[model samples]
Structure formats: structure tokens, C-alpha cells
Target: MSESKKILVPLLIALIIVSAFVSGCVDESSTSQSIQPQEEAVTEAETVTETTTEDVTEKETITVTDSLGRVVEVPKNPESVICSGAGGTRYLTYLQAQDKIVALDSTEDKVSVGKAYAIANSYFEGYPTFGQSGSENLEVIVSLDPQPEVIFTMYTTNGYDPDELQDKTGIPVIALKEGDMVQNREDMYQILRIMGEVMGKEDRAEEVISFMDATIADLNERTEDVSDAQKITCYAGGVGSAGSYDLMSTDSYYPPLYFINAKNVAYDPAAPKVAKVSKESILIWAPEVIFIELRPSQFEGENYAPYQLENDVSLNQLSAVQNEKVYGMLPYKFYSHNPDTALVDSYYTGTILYPDEFEDIVLEDKAAEIYGFLVCEGDVEKGMSVYETMLTISSTPVFTSLEFD
Candidate 1:
């Protein structure tokens, strides 16, 4: 009786195990089907995240607004570029963008812009030479070796439209004007960034822009306290129709003016862009300080007074003349109009106007700083020696202009 009972128990246990195995197999299939959609969703989410990360790494595009306020899209990295103005050359050099230049105009011919020309000669050796204003020999521009991808023009009163120029040359003409350059430094940085994009030198452009930002900040900190009371009115530009009394027109480049917070006697805020005063008018204003930008002829002219003092009673009566404040701002390099030049000119003028404010800076060191800043290899010390010698030879009442003419 006991053996039969054991066999029945074992048979019942085996039947129950077979039934559980069949149910578990069905459950496993249903669970896998449910998990497949979840897995698919996870895969889709991963794909979307990867796409978004890629977009984030892409570079930003730039849009430049021309003088007319038209927004134009430019290349993210232009391999070839052309600058049509002397001012533009300074910006390119400051941006370390000489490599991007495919062509440059002949604006460097004038002594006023010779430093830029010298830079081009030193750094941009075999590039094409586009003519200036009338010099942009249309034929030469059309024949550039590799052909330019873009052409840019600096701010100017009159110039050919870049778009039209591009249409004729099959290159995009991008205008980078400087009318708003002095108001905010952001404008300068933006232009440099845009140029970097066009020239494929964004990194160098940013570095240069940063350097300018820091330099300007340091300069402002040093010169912020300079007041109008301490400033000396500076007269720039070549003496106009008048001899020794002529001054630059109000609209001309007014360097060292706002830097020292000085009153510019020649400055007529209301003067039309073309308004120019005669020598008699300049004498009427008689600025406390006078600076002369002499041309070769003017520098050598018999009538020029940098060489003679006392006997020129006409000059002796002048306020600046009576005080020995008249200084012939010898052309340092080019016209002294770059960012460094502008600041240096302000420092030099500030010294002349208020010697106490810059007592620490001697004139010789100041001249050397300017030359070094401009990357001029010319011996600034020797140059200053020449200037000093010239001034001594010309400053006496007996010193008469030796006219070769």
C-alpha cells in the first residue's frame, strides 16, 4: 500500500512542473515584445542628442551691414580678400591679416599713408596691386593671378560700389566702412571678425582685436584724468593756402584732439564737410598749440618758419609763438593716424600742453615707443637726432630757408 502512494505523488509533481514551464515560456515572449518599443525609443533619443551636439559645434556665420544699411551675408572663411583704402591696411595689419590680402590699392603712394605701403612691401610681397581711387586699373583688378573671392573697401566719401565691382569681376565686393569706427570699439572688433571670416584668419583676428582692446583700456586708464584746462589745441594737416598760419580743415583727421580733451581752435563742429577757413581765420583763432604736417616742398620752403624765430615778428606775436609752444610735429611714420599713433600723438601733445601730466615720459623715449609700436625698423633715435638737428638749424632768426628752386 505504501509503494503505490509514493508513485502517485511523484507523477502529480512532474505534471505540475510541465504546466508551469509552458506558462513561463508564454510570459517571456510577451515581455520581450513589450521591451522592444522601449528599446526603439531609447535608440531614437540617442540619435537626436547626437545631431544636436553636432549643430552646437558648428561655427557662427556673419552678416555685414554696409553704409546704406543693407545686410549682406559673407563667407565664413574667405581665402582671398582685397582692401581698397589706406585705413583698411592698418586694420588688416592690426588683425594680423596680411596673409588674406589678395590685392591692395596704391593709396600708400602718399607720404600720409606710406607706413601702410611699407608694411605691404614687407609682409605682402607678391600680391596684386589694385590702383587707388583712379588707380584701381579695372583691367589689372580683373587679371589677378588666383582671382579674389572678396573685395572690401574702407569708408570714403566717394568710391565704386563693392557690389558693382563684384559683378564686373565675379568676386563679391564687401564694403567695410569706418564711419562708425571711433564711436565704439565693438565696431572695430566686428569688422575684424568679419574680415577674419572672409580671410580665413578668425583666430588671428580675435587675437589682434583682443590686443587692441587691452591696449586702449590701458591707455584710457592712464590718460582719463587729462582735462581741457590741461590740453593744448593742436593744428594738424598741411598748412593750407597760408604760410605758417594754415591749419587743417575741421573735418580732417583730428588726432590728439579728444584724447586730451583739448579744444581744437580749427575745429568747427558745424562746418560743412567741405568748409575750409583761410590762414587769416586760423590766426584769428590762434590756438595755444600748433602742429604742422609739412610736405616735401613745405618742409624745404623758404617761407616755412620752423627754421626761424624772433625776426618773424608775425609769428612772434602768435600766442603759441610767444610762448615757444609751436612744435613742428615732424611726420613720425606715415601721418601718425593709426590707433597707436593716435594715442602716442595724444601723449606727446599732452606733454606739450601739460608737461606735469606726463613728466615721467621723455620726448626721446616717447618717439621710440611710437616707432616700436608701428613695427618701424627705422632708427627712431637717429630719426629724432635728424629732427633735432633740423630744428636747431632752422630755429634761429638768422636761419633762412635755403631755396633750391
Candidate 2:
């Protein structure tokens, strides 16, 4: 019962209460601190997920097949492209997609592609030409100006890498398989379809393909079931070369030859490389019909020369020689494997193979009709002159009586 003692007891009790409140606040703060680490971990995991998504997006890729049988994967749509295949560069001209082409090969350099060549040469006069020396040089290809975004090589010929080329130069490699020179229009259309997809000119590509399809359909209707008896066996080649020197086989775009039921003197193997025949082999095969691919140099213009005919033998011994079934095709204009010329050659082969079936289908008149499709007006008079020149040496003089005009 002293007043001072009572006051001390109450003060001690108040201090204990304050201590308990402070301890409770500290425990609650510790719980909040425990939750903070979990929130930080969640945030870090979200950031990692976003980064992974970005990486995947950056690594997105696409693959395309080339003229050869190889498949190539590239970054999205390529801007600049280099074509290294037989008639590969012609696609640009066919589609009017020259702006996409950054470089071209030698055949294109020689202006071998007719109007397409002229147009591209005029447009890309300053661009480097790579395929001129019969082969490709990797160094020169790597040194191209404004380095190409994609390098497209032929499946059979162009020697380049898909992944390696990309790793070295950061450019994708595309394989554009070159169809057989004598391929049918359906095959050519498939090729065009692939080309259109690569060049981003699908509409134009389809248009050309449809036109070719119509042309081939018409040719088929005209020459279906040509007589086996009428089907002539043709032998062709350069004058001096003894190796394979015939026109294209089943692998080439000259399907019209097959359509007309004609047989080439050269036996087509399971896998054929060239469409030629040799002299020694020619002697053995001795075709029923002879077709010499007469060039401007070999056969002088309008005059089928007085050249030696195998040991100066009389023309009566050979079947074709006796019957004067020998003829000459225009080696210059009709020799190419381009879309335009291929169709012309197809029609030409059909007519030659089954003249009876195609009796109404005059060569010069058909040539003129095909001229519109070929994007060039072939000279009918020039064709007759070539035919006459081929028949000049014949003892029988078969071409002399035929009315070419």
C-alpha cells in the first residue's frame, strides 16, 4: 500500500504490453519477407520464358528443293537470289522477276536465252557473271556485289553448299532441279510452279504454265496414235563427234517424239546423260531416218554442202539414204532447251516423227504458229532453206520435189 509502489507496477505492466505488440509486428513482417522471394522467382521465370520465345522466333526457318535433288532450308523470304543451273536464270525473264536476281551463270552471259538474255543483260550489265567458264568458282561467288540473300544452284550441275554456304556467308542455298531437256509440258509446269514459289511470282508462273499446257494438249490431240510404220528412227549428232550425238531421249522435253511414235536410234538407258550418238555407233544403229542438226558453220546458209558421206559411199546403201528420209533441223534456233524453244522442238519432233499423222501439220506453218508461243517469229523461209541445204548432197534428191512453201 504505498502510492509510489502502485504506480511502478502499472508502468511495468504497460511496458510488457508494448513489447508484445512490437513482437507481433515483427512476426508479420517476417511472413511478408518470406513471400517476397517467391514473387521475385516468379518474375525471373516469366522473363526466361519471354527470352526463350524470342530465341525461337529468331530461329524460324524454311526449306526449298533445287533443280538437283537436294533440299535447302533458309531464313524467311530471300531478297537477292543467284541462279546457277541450265536455263535456271531464264525463270527471271519468264516471270519478269529480274529484280529478284542478283547474279547469273555463263549461258545467260552468252546471251543464250534470246530476248530474256537481252533483257537481263541490259538490266544487270554491272552484275557479276558466275557460270561462264563451264563451272562455278566459290571465291567469285562469295565476292558478288551486295552479296546475295540466296544462292540457287542446279541439282545436277551447280556445285555449291546449302548449310555451309549459309554458315559462311549468311545466305541460304536453294536447289532448283533442272528438268530433262526433253521434258513434257506437265514436267515443265511443275518446274515453273517451284520457280514461281521461290521468286514470289506465282501468278505469272501459273500463266506461263497454263499456256504451255494448252499448247501441249493441242499437240497431243493432233498427233495421237501416229502409225508405228510411220514412226521414223532418227540419227543426229555433230559431224566429227563419235560419242552420243542424237537428239534428246525420254528424259528431255521432246515428249512429242514419243507422242508421234518415233524411235531415236540411240538407245535410252535406264538413266541417260546426253541425247547424242556416235559415228561408230551410228554405223551399227543405222537409223531408218537421218536428222542432222545442221549449224550455220557446218552447213552453209541455204546450201546443204558437198561434205563427205562416210567413205564417199553411194547414198543407195542405207535405208534412209536410199529413200531420202534424211532431213536437217535448225541447229541454231531449235537447239535450245528453254521453255519457248522446247515447245517448238516438241512440235517439230512430232511432225518429223509422224509426217503422215501430221500431214496437215506443215512444218513451216506449224513453225509460224509456234512462233507466237515461242515469243519469236521463226523464219519459215529460213527453215526451208535449211531443209534444202540438208538435202543437197543426196543422190535421190528427195527434198527437191517437196513443196516447202
Candidate 3:
């Protein structure tokens, strides 16, 4: 073969090999590009499915039985809530779950001025009001921007039903019976537990109950050995519902008197729990010691019961008034019974009734300790001024005589 022929054959073979390699590379690249888009589409679809499933799970509802024995469906985690009736907001505040409160009753604004729970949580003053007790503004509640998920209220005497309220508002209404904290302590504890569950503060609720248990135990330990005859005969005055004070307003089942084992002259099992007695009865009881409920308006000189007791001629002849056994105590029934304040009042009562037994307890220091636990976030000094302003040595003169002007 000639040189030219040899070169042309080799060139032709070389060209064929190059063209085949290029075609194989193009086919592989096309296959890889087609597979990539399919893989990406599968991955995106999986992500969307997972997100939808998670949202559905979060919206799931759980069934719970309220204080009234009604089984209702409530959100797994309630984000917003409305408190109605007496002591409704107080229970929430005790749990430190005030952040969940979407709206408050009008009474909260007035009571929050000097009250321990109210004074500690002044932010609640700005939230919208949902009307007063026995009258809740359903329209305003529904119009709330985020809308509340649950409603907590006390059982009323006028036949207000939780089931009916729930139906009307399309929100879960849990009715709790505000039983006497001293007589029906378990009921109060159950109420706290239920509220804690609703507000996601179960641990905090347990803490409150434990504190109450510890307080009662401590009081009993100090007074257990004292004889019944040694117990001071006492009468509590100026006690009423929703901050209303009557000269004869009193409760037979008052917890402070009960817990401290003091002999309550007004206690009669047959009589109503709370009633306004005749002035003649006050003379008849003639208690050795008289505890007058201090009012916020005493400074304003309007409807001050302590001053009324001081000036009343009929009460002057009594041993309590004659011997200066009359003392001022924090109003136990402002809006509703304040368990924390009531506990503190018991210590004060115990200290006065039996000075020797409670000698180690400084009333102010004890009050500060309780305030720290319940209202001051464990800071003993932080809400002490509010407590201090409630009573003073001149006001609550147990051993000393008050030289009134």
C-alpha cells in the first residue's frame, strides 16, 4: 500500500473512535440531568407532607372533666383564656399563668389597686374588661383579636350553667365551686390542680398546695398543746363579699380563726356561713378579742369600719373595745377569699392570741416570708411594703393600748 493510503486509513479509524466517545459522554450527561429533577421533586413533596401532618397533630383536642363534673374538649395547649366570676383570676395569678389571660372582669381593676395579687400584677390593669360578676360581655369576648380558647368561672346561685355558657360562646367554660377554703380545702386544691392543667402550670399548682399544707402544719404544731379554755374568744368584723363591709358582717367558717384554733364567738353550725348580725348579738357575744377588717378607703375617710367600731357607743362597753383587744386585719373577703392573705392573717391572729407560743415569729417577718412565696417571686423584700401598709403597730395593737384621737 502507498504512504498516502496508509495515512488516510489511520485518520479514518481515529475519527470514528473520537465520534463514538463524544456520543457516549452526551448520553450519560442527559441521563444524569433527567434523574436530578425527579429526585428533587420527590424530596419537596415529602417535606410538604411532613409539615401538614405536624400542623394537624398540633390542632388535636383533649377531653377533660372540670370541677362541675362536665367532660369537655379543650385545646392541648391553651394560648389565651378568659377568667370570670369570683376568685377566677386570683387562681390564675397564683399559678403565675397570668400571661394566658386574654381579658379580665371589671372588678379586677378596682381590687388590683392595693390587693396583694393585684398590686403584684399591675399589667393586668391594662387588659380589656369582660364586664363584672354575674354579667360577662360575650360580644366583647368574641370580638377579641386572637380570641380566648377557654373560660373559667365560679358556679353562681342564679342557675348559670357552664354547659350553656360554653355553647353560647363556642369556647370551653369550666365551672368551679368557690367552696370555703378552710372547710373545703380539698375542693380548693382540686380547683388549683384543674386550673394548673388548663394553664400548663401543674408544677406551680402543686407548689401552692404544698405551701398551704406546710402552713397549716406549722400552725398546728405551735397551737396543738394549748387548752381550749386558754384559746381566746374572738369575733371577726367588717367581713363581706366583693369588698362590701358591714359593721356586723362576719363568717362562722372563717379559715384564719379556724386554722389558728381560736374560739370564734360567732361560730354556729346551724347559722349561715356569712351573715350580718344584729348589734344586740355583738353585745351578747362580748368577745375577748375583736378583729376588724381593714379597708382601702380608711385613708379616704369613706366607709371605714374600723373607725365606725371605734366610735360606736354600744360596742364601747364590750371587753374587746374596753381592754384594747380590737385589732385590724387584712380584708379576707375582698372580691373573694384570699387564701394567701388569710394564711398570713392566721399567723398574726395566733401571735396575738398566744404570744408565748408564737414568740419566735415576728409578725412582719412572717408576713414578708409568705408574701415572698406567694406574690414576690421568692424575693422576701419585694412586695413587703404592700403587706406592711396593710397593718401597723398603731393599727393592730394586740398587747398595747391605742390612744385614739
Measured over all alpha carbons after superposition, the RMSD of each candidate to the real structure, in angstroms, is 12.3, 12.6, 3.9
Per residue, candidate 2 scores C-alpha lDDT tens digits across 100-211 of 7777675555432223234323656666776542366667778887677677655543344554555665667665545543433455566666667766668878777676
Off by over 4 Å in 3: 1-46, 49-54, 298-303, 383-386, 389-405
lDDT of each: 0.55, 0.53, 0.78
**Residue-level lDDT tens digits of model 1 in 322-405:** 666565543322332355545555666666666665678675566454444333323566434432332332222111212210
Runs in model 1 deviating more than 4 A are 1-76, 110-127, 155-159, 180-190, 202-253, 267-275, 296-316, 330-337, 362-405
Candidate 1 residue pairs in backbone clash: 78-198, 131-135, 131-136, 132-135, 307-394
Task: Report the lDDT tens digits of candidate 3 across residue range 87-173.
Answer: 888788778887788888887887464367777677887899978756777788788867999988887865447877788789998
TM-score per model over all chains: 0.62, 0.59, 0.84
Q: Find the 10 residues in a row with the least total lDDT in model 3.
A: 393-402
Best by lDDT, which number?
A: 3
Candidate 3 local distance difference test against the native: 0.78
What is the RMSD, in Å, between candidate 1 and the native fold over all Cα? Answer: 12.3
Candidate 3 displacement at residue 227 in angstroms: 2.2
